[model samples]
Target: MAKVQFNDVSFSYGDKKIIQNLSLEVNDGEIMGVIGPSGCGKTTLIRLLCGFIKPETGSIFIGETCVFDAKKRINIPPERRNIGVVFQDYAVWPHLTVLENVKYPLKKKRMDKKQMQEIAMNALKQVQMETYANHLPSQLSGGQQQRVAIARALVSSKELIVLDEPITNLDLKLRQEMLKEIREIQKTIGTTIVYISHDQEASLELCDRLAIMDQQGNIRQLGNDYDIVMKPKDRYIFEFVGISNFVDVVAKEDGVYINAQNGLVKLDDKSVLENPTKAYQLAFRPMDAVFDNESPIKGKVVTETFLGNITNYFIQLGDKQIRLQQSALDVMKYGKAKEGQEVGLKFVRKFYYEKEEA
Candidate 1:
């Protein structure tokens, strides 16, 4: 499989720039997921790689082949690039049967019927839809149709597959199933798949590496799921990823000054206060919030959700809602802490984000 690289890639519509001089590499055989808010240029990035829109002032390369280099004014046609793309809508032709849809790629080449069927059947079975070869796209369910689309893409033996929001339209169960199948197929083929999505859960489960594209069209951070979730680079990331707990505190030279009911209790973590925006919000997962018996700071448990092995509790800690997720076995109680109970609150490992802009 070939590695995809964007060298100082920039794209614009007339005067306004959608993507700046952003550059990154999708390692060979790695499923690099592109995630960000809507209109953050995720789709635009795909178009550039697919050779739909040539970079305005940079180059895009597929394993050393400069497909688009604005300096040289090179523009390769989309069809000639030989990149496989599976869009969100499951683009299967309604007029064709499942076998015809999967075998369409081989039709262009002079492959014999047996060879074509071999490729199509192997791909179909890989997606677990070989029995539906005679079925039309309309007859199959949405998930099944998407599998057909995947099979069609695989039948060509293309190394790089660009999937743009491939699972957004499916129901919950099917979405999960299709995600599993897609990951398996990618692993089985060892193809470099660029899976694009706005959802974090999907990206966390599928991608080996993730690039978070933010507004103003910049790749803010790129790393593993742990970096994206636990150590967000900024406040925009804390909100984008749906993190549960947030504490707005000011940095006093000594420590973080969080306003408590009795007074502003300073929880010392001097190392994290080194940044210029030291007056930051600590964004932690609900699971990170702890209930300590000896702690002086307290919060009333506003609500509780008993989820078998773990329980989720939302505590009213001063003016903010500090959601806590803990293992059911760790706690002795199941019911909500009585109103105004003042359950002791302790800050566990907190996620530090640049303070929110007023």
Candidate 2:
């Protein structure tokens, strides 16, 4: 296993900077998930780490070895970096059988034929593809192909593995299964892994820690799944990661007060507000609020969607449209609320941030 570190790493393509003095670390054997919107430099970071592209500045280290150091002009080739990568497309050769594909990476190791075959078989067994050793890529399913690709990556002495949207091509069931398998294999082998994806749900499920990158090519937040979800650092991170309702508020010594057109709500945490009389943004998740008949904050329901276990309502109050999600059981208990019905909203919890001035 290896620990990867990036110190002031920066990269750019032509005139556009993709990564701006980014610095982070992934500990040995830890699975770190890198998540961001498209064009947020997640893929570029992967490329820079794997030696596919050299960074314009800074250094990258794997364990004690300096793989890429701009100051020293040290640039190690991808094969010598002792890292394995699984791409979104699987990237297995159609002409090679499963066993051959797995053994291909080991061909340069000067091992005997039997030793190479044994190592390849063991790798395939780790991915549960040993029985299909002779099958060609054309004959295997997408999931099966992905397994072979993983087996190929693990067949060598790689200390770190980079998975770039590895499960994106699979169905929902297969994706979930693959996630379990990946986690299990990583634990068993104790290989440090970097998982990059645009899917937040998958990242939340599979990562030991998450690194959220913003559109400005910088790390926005780095923490556990719950910390990132429940306590985002700012408005941009909160809105990018999950659903939130924003209301304008006035700051005060005792609390931050929300002055909605139809009602008022006060936040108990005085520290959230920097000063009195300044406008703040009150952000809360859909699950944090409820519909109260007597609430002073009112809205007209524009649409109601029944999403299996939960129901979502898009309500319009003044110039803003707010979303609220409630359990189906709650809807049943309260009776289904109809569209066009004006309903009151009560805040159960909220997050406070200083409003960005336009």
Candidate 3:
């Protein structure tokens, strides 16, 4: 399998800069997910890697080969790069049978029919589509069609594959099944994958490592799911990673305090405040906050939603509303808080950030 590397990569579209001085590496035999909001250069990054578009500045390497170098003026074409691509649309030819679709990539090598069939069948087997080899894509489900696309990508013995929102078109159940299938196939073949998506849940569940990009086309953070979620580098990363609540708080000589519905409530930890005189935001995940009757911080329950496994609560503290989540088991034990109920809040995990501008 090949490792992909981008060194000081910068790309622009006319006057608009999409990426700037971005450097990231995808290790061999690992699923590296690049996730961000829409128009965050995720697609542009993939296009640059696949040689569809050249970067304004920087070098790209696949394994040991320098596929692109601005200074050296070396660029290997996409076909020669031996990189497989599975797009969001499945890209399976509707007219062709599953086996034919898988064999299509091998045809350019001028292989004999028997050898091509053998390789194609092997690829289909890897994706568990061998039984439906003769079925046309129109006859297959969306998930099945996606498998055909993946098999086609793998048919040419491609060690590196790029999946661009591959499961976005599938239903929720199909997405989960496809994710499991992909992880299994990766383990079986050890292909280095570069997964591009805006879905935080999918990327967190599938990727070995994640690269978070911002709208400014910068790599904000790169790490595992746990680190990126629990130890976010900044407020942007925290907010992007999951459902987050940010409450405005003022740092005083006594301690950091939030303007609760009752009055000012002192935070337990004063060390998190960066400046004693400035206002900051206390950011935490919905799951990290709990209702505690003894805590001084108070909020009125604006709404409570039972979302299957968890009970979601929107608590109004002063003028700001923040979300909190409780497990169904906890709700069963302690009973659900009613609307308009004034509840005490205790934050289990929180981070401080400069208050956002109005």
Candidate 4:
């Protein structure tokens, strides 16, 4: 029920800077996802928000409480922050039963045994684990253990719930089920959840808003799923979200001049043409590109993988490889493409990225 805010936060380990001056806000009852590659500052940010690591030069606010303030030299302890954290490894005590694990957090309060048991059972049922209340952690499966962990967090009724790669260890089927379950639980209880993961696709699908962080701990982009996937702002982001084919071309007054094509390809967004002298990288999604029989652009299919509904083709044109994902039905209409087959490719939608200065 609380909004989390980080204002100009910066954190470092010894002399190595992990998180730079970053500011982000998660609205009350919102599920915000934090995604990045390995070694990025995703976990560090969680630690800072939980009050385990204090920012060197900023303030963090959880609802009305100023949990951390560098200038004022104030740092609130984790227990007082009223935040629940579900670690990547479901941190359940092997000796404790499902009910005991959920009731452990409530033991800190002076609630009677009967009341605690009722609350704990309710939390377990929330996660559909009430039937296994007497089962120890060692007897339960990984997914069951995860359910116990979530129930433990829910029993506290904290303001913010941070799930660090909660479904990473689960199988594909179990992951999907857990994803839906987590969303349902959050919506049912109206608790603000922050999902942290390295998988861009899962984060994009699960979160209302996303924050993409880089290896250097910089926030590369922040937006909804469509914006981040379709129109990436940077080269790093373009390659991270999905497969994209890049073509090098020079910008002109009228359009982008493709040296290989020896013709101008008109772009919808003319902003990249501002720097007429420099070359820009034009990117388009594989699914957006279509194979045309008459188009001059040609490539040899180096590899093709059948994935039931869609077939992914890796075509080599000169030295560059362009990936195209064609629907199985479309392939049937056109004709199943084989390796070493010469195909004409044309992009229906494209985006441009400015060349980075060396």
- For TM-score, the strongest prediction is 3
lDDT of each: 0.80, 0.84, 0.88, 0.82
The 10-residue segment of model 2 with minimum total lDDT is: 261-270
Q: In terms of TM-score, which candidate is stronger, 2 or 4?
A: 4
Clashing pairs in 2: none
lDDT of 1 by residue, 1-358 (tens): 8799998998897888999999989999999989888878888899899987778778888876878888898888887677878776646898999999999988987899999999899889999999999999899888888888888878765688888865355787887787798799887889888888867887888789899889878988898888877777776776777765677777776767775555676765665466755467767777666777667776777787788887777787778877787786557643335445677767777766666557
On a 0 to 1 TM-score scale, where does candidate 4 land against the true structure? 0.90
Q: What TM-score does candidate 1 get on C-alpha atoms? A: 0.92
What lDDT tens digits, residue by residue, belong to model 4 across residues 1-358? 9999999999999999999999999999988999888889898999999988888989999999999999998899988888878877656888999999999989988899999999999989988999999999999878788888888888776578888875455776776677788899888988999889766777788889899998999889999998898778788998889776887766766666543332443433445565666668778788887777766666778999999889998887655677889897668656667898887666777877776665
Off by over 4 Å in 4: 166-168, 250-254, 257-272, 332-335, 354-358
Sum up the clashes in candidate 4.
Answer: 0
Best by lDDT: 3
lDDT of 3 at 53: 95
Which order, best to worst by lDDT?
A: 3, 2, 4, 1
lDDT of 3 by residue, 1-358 (tens): 9999999999999999999999999999999999988888988998899899999899999999999999999999988888888876546998999998998989899999999989999889988889999999999988888888988888755689888875355788887787888898899889998888767888899999999999999999999989998899998998899998888887887778898998888988757576666668889988888888888999999999988899999999978999999997677655689999999888889999987888
**Which RMSD values do the candidates have, in order?**
2.4, 2.8, 1.7, 2.7
What would the per-residue lDDT of candidate 2 be over residues 208-237, giving only the tens digit for each residue?
A: 999999998999999999988888998888
Sorting all predicted structures by TM-score, with the top scorer first, yields: 3, 1, 4, 2
